[model samples]
Target chain A: MIDLMQFTFMQRALVAASLTGAVCALIGVFVVFRGMSFIGAGISHASFGGVALGFVLNINPLYTAIGFCVLVAWLIGWVTEIGRLREDAAVGIFFASTMAMGVLLVSLIKGYQIDLFGYIFGNVLAISRNDLIAMAVLALLVFLVIFFFYKEFLLLTFDAEMAAVTGLPVKWLNFLMLTLMAFTIVLSIKAVGIVLVSALLVIPAASAVQLTAHFKKAIIYAVFIGVVSCWSGLFLSAFLNIASGATIVLTATAVFFICTFLSPQRRKMRRRIGTLVKTQNS
Target chain B: MTTPVIDLQNVSVAYQDKIVLQDITLSVSPGAFLGILGPNGSGKTTLLRTMLGLTDPFDGTVRVFGKEPKKLKRLREKIGYVPQQSHIDLTFPIQVKDVVLLGRAYKMGLGKRPHNQDREAVEEALELVHMTDFADEQFGRLSGGQRQRVLIARALALQPDLLMLDEPTAALDVGAAESFYEWLHNTHKNLGLTLVLVTHDVGVVSRYVTAIACLNKRLVAHGLPENVLTEEGLQAMYGCDAVFFHHGKVPHLVVSTRDPEKT
Candidate 1:
């Protein structure tokens, strides 16, 4: 594990995993809070469509994936605004159709022998310099957006109607959050793939909730857990010559289990505290 | 005489083909406490949203301070709203102070961060509602009444000139609900702000509100509580007749009614 860091590819893999994990988990806090887990799923699958479209156009798959994902994100936002259908239902329909379209596009590509499994399951060690640079830019954007609109996002996620009433441009902020989620998904797609990307986004936060009741603490715990899993998975995958994405997810899963087991339920803890207070006074 | 802060001129809203609020005209003066009374699906919430410009009217105009509600971006700075539900995840990790700080997002905008002013406003707001002690508590850890108070503090942090509450005590116990209404009126009086509350507890809130607006897909009536709470007005707003009785044990009026249209 120590010797693995000696290689450049291993180093790149570590960097990619950390950045991707951190960004996804941060955005995931909103996603989970907003109950937009399905939206994340939809965007990830839609990125697959972008990949196929890129293959068809003979361009870099990342560009097409990001483009298609963003376009789809905008469409979902626009359609939901039409007020004709529930947002989740609209996103679900868009996702199903886009996924099928991308699959068909991929199947039609001439001599499609690559199998394209990497885009689905991910190949973190295979990240190019360009991909690393893209991840960096995306990480910066994610940080900026989260930092800039932290208050508005908090209000919107918790109570959009109240946010709107408070004059925060709730509609626009919601659209922006959706767009950013798409952007984050596209950026992390090459690292964890669509199937597992949401794991990076949701699991760490869920686990963090077990240990802390404060929003900021939960976020801090999620980032800490995510970075740990990324580094550990990167090294473990390198030494074992296994799939980096899968290994990272495994590490996260293990973390979640440990946290869940050790973390006490809040209600029970409160009850115990009440008893202790009574005993101390008596 | 003071100018009206909210003016609704023939405003109407429809969801799909079904109209929720028809052309309704009403005006509320600053510092007036207006209680909106209606049954479920009576467009009480829609009326409030229209006033806030969160929902667009199909016809006519709604104005806040003589300007269109849409143009009231700055007007929102002067308005505070406590929704029927705060919509925050109980499981999400957020402290009461953090939730309260969200009220200043309008004044804070994109690049700037919240400062001492915002924090002080949050503290003041919490203090007004008697929830200052819970300022450091996690939002999810609060009881229903405690959570409601926190939400009210979030709105109050705006230092609004107009305060709108949608069923503020909907999920609270009877005792808690009464106390919440008391605090609401007390705050309104102390701040000298316009207060609009949506409630089914018409008799209880009638004393607190300066006027009452009864809505059932339209503005059935709006006037002093004595005029708006008449039998006809109550029947029109609720689609049923109400029985009024006073128990010596309880100082407040108790109203019991059945389904309106059936009778």
Candidate 2:
């Protein structure tokens, strides 16, 4: 463990893990509160399609992933807003179709894709300096937008109609929200891998909500949980020589279960049940 | 005479083939506690939304504070609106104070945090709703009646000239519902604010509101409570021979013979 710092890849991996964990959790707070978990799932899967397209075009997969994911995210937003179909049902259609596109696009490449597996099951230790820089830049962009429009996002999630009534540009803001989610996915996708990206986006926030009544605190706790589990998972995966993405997600999932047990809401329900039992006995 | 707070002229709203509201011409004067009385799906909510410019009217103009609602965006700042079903996202992680602080978002503008005045406004609004003690509690942890009060406080924190409430007590029990009306009555009297409440309780409308507008896709009657609460007005709005006679403890609409239940 002492010699771990000597390895530059370990240093880069730790930094990438921290960046991916915190940013994904930040956006995850809104995604979870909005109950748009499926949207995140759909966007992340669409990112896989982007990567496959990038491989076929012989270009940076990151750029194509951004293009593909943002378009799909906006399309899902439009479908939900138009009231033509239920939100999950619309996202479900995109979720399955995009993955199929990704599968088809990957097959179009004549030879085995060398870098494909890196994205599917992420290799954080393999992160280069440029990848770290890209992750940092994207994380900063997500932070700036959320900082400026924090109030608007809060109101939109709490009650969109009320936000619209208060003269806020609800439609444009909604687009901006989808765009942010896309950027966040692109930011962390390379390091966390495609499959574990949505889990990172959802789990920490889910755990945070169980413990706190305050939204701000939930964000804080989510980031805290995210960073800790990310660092530990990276360390444990290295020591045991296991899959890093799966280890991190399992660690976070375990934390979520623990949070549920300690949740104040659960305690209240327990008290109610205890009284019910007493009444029945009497 | 003072100018009216809200004025509409021959407004019609449609969703594809269905007409939600039609040919509605109504004006509400200042200091008027008006009740929009109608059954479910009778355009009571649509009429309210039209006045707020949430839904566009296919014909005629909807003016609030003497200007078109869509044109005068600032009109929203002067209007406090508590929308229907205030208990949205009960499990959303938010404190009651933060929920109330959202009402002050317009004044705070973009990228700015709440200053002293903003905090004071939140405190004042919570105090007005009598939920000051629960300011730090989770909004989801509160009872249904308490949640409604907190939502009302959120609207009141805006410090608007006109107030609108849609089915404020729809989810509340009888005891809580009565208290909600009493609180609204006091708020109207003390603030002297123009209030438009959408409700279907004919008896409560007669007892509390100064004026009434009965709607059944179209405006059936619009006048003083005494004039609009008659049997003819009731029948026109509800599409049945509903008599306002005393059968139970409280006087309510009793449907007699020849009743046609419309879906």
Candidate 3:
């Protein structure tokens, strides 16, 4: 594994994993806090349509995926704003429709397609220079946006009504969040694949929330967990000749479980229950 | 008289296609402590939201600081708003001090972190609510009354001339609720700020607020509490069976609802 770092593909894969994990985990904090997990899942699945269209039209799938993901994300945001139905309901509809479109589009393509399979299940070790550059640029853009709008997004996630009443452009901020989420999902698709991309966005944040009572600390922990899981999972997957995405997700899940087991809230609840039972018996 | 800070003339508001507030006209003067009284689903929260510009009215106009509350960022800055306790997402993992600090974000301008002055303001606000001890506590972990106080501190941290609270004591215990009302009354007295408190608690309205607005999809009455807290006015807003009275020359207020509306 140490010697493999000298190879460009291994290096690119490691960088790709870290970049995807960090960006997704950062956006995932807001998504989890705002209870937009379904949107994350929906947008990732929806990006599949763009990837399919790219294959069908013979264009770069990244552009198409970003376009489709943002459009679907905005539509979901619109549905939420117009109060048409619940945001999750909109996601549920779009989730199935996009996957269906992707499947039909894939079927239209000729014989065996290994590139399409990579998009579906991911092959981090097969990452190219172009993919790495795209991922870095997109990740940097996300980081800049998150950095600039950190306060607004925090207030928005904590309480959007207060954010609005405090005179923040909550509507614009909300749409911006969706756009960022869309971008994060698209950039992440190559590393984790369209199928498990939401997990990359979700698990690290979920684990972080379990470990800390503070929001800022939680975000830091999420980024740490994300980068650590991705890097270690890449090494472990290579050593075992297994799938990187699956190993990374499983690693994150394990961290979440450990955090849950050591959670102070869980301990507090256990103590409270013990006292209650003892008093009742007395 | 000093100019009214919040003026809504013939305002009609609808939420989710259901008419909530209709033909409402209200004026809050400086230093006036006003209570918005209603039963459940009486559109009390909608009225406050309309004033705060969170909910756009279907008809008429809502003017905060003589401008549309929705359009004027300055209007939002000048008015402190505390939404309904349930409206907050309890799952949000935030500390009490951070919540209070968020109140200063707009004042600090775009893309700026909290400065020293903002930190002092947060501490002052937390101290005002007697919640300095819970400054580091996670907001979601606090008890209902404690959370209520933290929310009030967040609003107070804005240092606005006008403060509007929607059912602020809904989650508070009896003792905490009384203390909060007392502190609010004292703050109104000392700061000379306009306050609009929305609640179904008739006793609270009769006790703390100097003025009253009884609501039931319309402005049933708005005047000094003594002039508006009559039995007839209570019935007008809260169906036919509502009551308000005194026992043996002692001041007492009770409201009985035969059919309480769902919020």
Candidate 4:
């Protein structure tokens, strides 16, 4: 175990994975609560187009991915607000088109297929010092925004109409949330790749929600689950020679299933069903 | 005259080319319990939205607290709004106390948590709604009636001068609806708060509201409930004759039906 930390790549991987996990899970809580899980999935896939474009244009994929993700986030927000289409429908439209572009761009690439594959499937061991810096900066920004606007976000997620009537800038805050989500997804692409990034965004938050009835508690639990799964999954992957992203997602899913069985809400539901059965028999 | 809490003059609202409200004029005085009655798609919600500054009128001026509706940020502090209960996701993992405490968001501003005064306000609101015992419980675990009361309590925590509700009793049973109205009446009387309710139930307006505004894309009638709730007024608003009767002190309306044989 100590020998693993001796490797600089392993040390970088650990730091990057933990930061990505924490930030993605924090944003994930809002996603799950507001029923924007599809948006998360959409934005993450949209980043693939950016990555492929970067490869073709010989630019840093992360930067291009950030730009692409932000554009898609704004598009989703705008379409949903215009009331011409449902949010899920907007998400679906972006999801398919962006991925289609990404596949087309990837096919056009002459070489560096291996490098592109790293972003598509994620290679935690390949995380550079600059990538760690980007993740740190983004994670800091994300945390600060959430800290300052915690109450506002809570109210918006709970009752957006009430928030708007109370003079909160509901539309701007919505765009801000989506933008933050896009940045978080872009940052996590190094740890989980484009395809698996949404799992990190949703699974920890979903698991946390099952365990708690309060928003604050749910957030704490989500961050905890995210960090734990990241660290454990990284170590497990390194030891077992498996994929880090898949391991982390599987770990988070396992926690979610366990929480589903042990949650108070689940017990109450079971009791409700038991009484219904008994009443019918009587 | 004392400044009206809400005053809308010749306000017309449109979504794209479709006009939802046309040349509607109304005023809500302080301490007035005004119920707005309208048929489906008759702009009752658009009226509420215009008053709250959530929607811009295509024409005419809207005032809340004697100022332009959009420029009433300070005035908004004195206003509490409870949206339709159906809009809320009940299973969204929020505690009752937290839900009520959201009323303090504007007061707290950015980066500020709920202080002692905010907590006290929440507690008082919970007590007013008779939900003090369930303050720590999950909001989703409560019954439909209880959830409605909790939503009201959330608004009450704002210590608002005017409380507005949009179809609050839609999801409630008869007993719960009565109790909710009773609670509103007491709160209005005791707190001296103006209450604006948008509803389709004629009984609610006829029984509890001090003033009634019948609207169908426009203001059909605006007066005391007994005067505004006549068969002719209801017919004009609902596009059909409706029978009005009183069960005890509460007035009810039943849509009229004509049989071919009778005709």
Candidate 5:
């Protein structure tokens, strides 16, 4: 029963976590709907190469990771356009190889940077002003990208060939969508580790889907779920002296299960109070 | 008659190790309903893909309005497409209006929102398909026939001069399929839009289609239904007896093949 307003770090942690959660879940709506979950996963791991490169080069890891992730996102789009290979297989090979390369690079660097583990699993307590600013900018970018091309991306995801016939550059628009997804993945990577990034990206939206029939409402609900998970996880982890990222993911998973179980739309039959008693007695 | 809107001359398409289409030549006249008929593996889809410029021909060319199909941006504006129902996963959460709005993607300028014109077109397309009431509905909840109508509205929203539908009635009940065909014919006649349908049901679509192109591994026949769907043509296309059953206006071709075990 601790008051949430007392500590400055706790407040910052809550704000940062909420922002990251909302952004990931917002983008996750598209990821799950577009069947781009594999690509989203690939981008998360691929950004590891970027982060490792930043460490080896003594640069701001966030900038380096964002750049690297965006580049790989474009590459995935290129391969998909060429149609020389299956999209999922191509993304799998590239990300797996890049992740291996990243791990190898991390070990090869001179000193033991223990902060690396924090980046992978996240340290919500260590979130800085710079991280907050970066998250805000990336979140804004995601909003704009989604707003401007909502129709095109929607059509591209559902039926690309028809989108193309309508004169939309379905190939280029798809590439742009993947690129945005990469940026969103990179933004969440610092808050949630690469391994758990997709959880942040997917869980809230998955939960929201149980409650809403409209895409716009689903997005709004997902963002709400995301913010709740982030703040609750931060507060609970602080109380328990536990890892924040894992705690937040666990919270989101719980929310998803609860929503799924209690979803009225999913029930086989509407429950009347009298009917429930009759069934139980029978 | 006006010059053919689509003309393919000796077009061929190949995958890594295998050729999917070979030396195909055809022309689709303006405002004519052309049906491309073939069996499952007969490369009808490949031909449509090549025509759309999504697949490059190994040799020869595809022309839309006398320009290369891939390079003609303006010409593409006049083309609408509804690919096979199997190609899309209905679980994706896209609204019907959002799906229809995709038809405006090509016409929309960079950074511009869908304007009044686009909205009107979407509305009109929905009205034409009798789906105006479901504009707000999530596409995933629609029945198969309803989904097909939404898809048709999406294509129709493009305001294309030519519409290509690939197995548009696949996985539909006979009543639903016949109604779709009737809607397609009405739209084609009313709008003066060329309609191209790729299907296995030549007999079913023959009445609406002004012409038929019977294909197996090759162009077996290409002409009026009376000429292209003869007994010899049916045997060549199906490799068996194709019994034609008529229910007033519609024809159903039922294929009965000899047992392969006996052969």
Candidate 6:
């Protein structure tokens, strides 16, 4: 592992892994809390279209993906707010259409289908210094926005109607949150790929929720689980020459299962049931 | 003499092409304990949303705090609102204290953290609702009535001049509902805050509220509970003959269904 760190590519991959893990999990807390896991899944998959568009236009795919993801996020918000369609329905529509577009664009490319696969499955070892910088900037931006609007976001997540009644600009705040979620998904694609990014966005948060009953503590636990899973998964993948993205996601899932098994609420319920049985027998 | 705190003049609200409320007019004076009674799908929730500025009336005008609903930014801070308890997600991981603290988010301003005053306000609200002991407990772990009380504490943390509740006692048991109304009545009497409650329970409206408005797609009657909770008033609101009775001085409206064969 020390020898692996000596390589510049491995160092860059480590930085990318940690950054994506922390940022994705932070945003994931809100997504999980608000029951918007489908939105995360939709946005990550939608980025494939942006990636294809970038390749077709002969520009950086990350830039194109960013623009495309933001556009899709805004569109989802608009459709839901219009009240003609439900949020999940809008998400489902965009998710399928964008993926379809991506498939069409990819077929148009004559050669190097392997490049597209790299984006789809992720190649952590291929992370460049520029990618690391972009990830860092995005991570910083996401953290700053969350920090500034922490209270408002908490209120919106807990009770959106109450937030609106309290004059919190609920609609705009929702759009901003979705936009930030898009950025997080886009920045994380290189680490976990589009197919597995939603896992990074949801699993750690779900695991953290089982361990804590407070939102702030849940976020802290989620970030911890996210960073640890990514670090350990990256190490194991490098040692075994396995798929890093899948390994990271599996590691997070493992954490979620462990948390579920040890959840205090579950234990309390079991204890109450045990007491009831004992009382009935007596 | 004084202008009404909430004034809706010939207001009509619609979702898309379907009209939910049609040409309804109401004016609530300061310190009035107004109860809005209507059956399910009778636009009770829509009326509260209109006053909160969450919905725009398709016709006529709405004024909250003597100004247009859209221009109530500063005035909004002075209005505390508690939506129905069913709207809250009980499974979400949140503590009672944090939930109450959310009430001060707008007042804390953008980018500023909660200060000592905000904490004090949260504590005071919890005490007011008699939930100070449960402040650190998980909000999801509480029973329905307890959760309702916590939600009320959250709204109270806003320290508003008007407190609006929509079907606050809908999920509570009979005993719990009775106590909830008693608590609300005491709170109104002590705080001297204007109160507007939307509920389907005629008993609650007759027992606790000073003024009553009955709505069924439109305003059926509006005045004192004694005047508006009569058999004639209820027939106009419910579209059916209702028998009015008093149980221990509490008024109750029982809808009478006539058999077609007998008619």
Using DockQ as the measure, the top candidate is 6
Question: Which is superior by TM-score, 1 or 6?
Answer: 6
Measure candidate 5: CA RMSD: 2.9
Cα-based lDDT at residue A227, candidate 2: 91
The 10-residue segment of model 5 chain B with minimum total lDDT is: B246-255
- Alpha carbon deviation, residue B82, candidate 3 (Å): 1.4
State the interface C-alpha RMSD of candidate 5: 2.0
Model 4 C-alpha lDDT per residue in residues A72-185, reported as the tens digit of each score:
999999998786899999999999999999999989988657887778778888999888888888889999999889999999898888888878888889999999999999
- Ranked candidates (DockQ, high to low): 6, 4, 3, 2, 1, 5
lDDT of 3: 0.86
Error of 3 at B143 (Å): 2.0
Q: List residue ranges in candidate 3 displaced over 4 A.
A: A268-282, B247-251, B255-263
lDDT per residue for candidate 1 within B108-210, as digits (tens), equals 8765788888889998988887888888888887999889888888888888888888998887989888778887777888889998898878657876889
Q: Tens digit of lDDT per residue, candidate 4, span B87-142?
A: 78877989999999998788777668889999999999999999999999899889
What clash pairs does model 4 have? none
Ranking by lDDT: 6, 4, 2, 3, 1, 5
Native-to-model Cα distance after best TM-score fit, residue A214 in candidate 5, in Å: 1.1
Q: Is candidate 3 or candidate 4 better by DockQ?
A: 4
Model 2 residue A246 lDDT score: 85
Instruction: Please identify which of the two predictions, 1 or 3, would achieve the higher TM-score against the true structure.
Output: 3
Pairs clashing within candidate 2: none
| Displacement of the residue A128 alpha carbon in candidate 5, Å | 2.2
Model 1, position A140, has a per-residue lDDT of 90
For each candidate, what's the DockQ? 0.68, 0.70, 0.73, 0.79, 0.58, 0.81
What would the per-residue lDDT of candidate 3 be over residues B9-68, giving only the tens digit for each residue? 999987667888999999988888889998889999888888888789989988888888
Q: Write down the RMSD of all candidates, one decimal each.
A: 3.3, 2.6, 2.6, 2.5, 2.9, 1.8
Worst 10 residues of 1 chain B by lDDT: B245-254
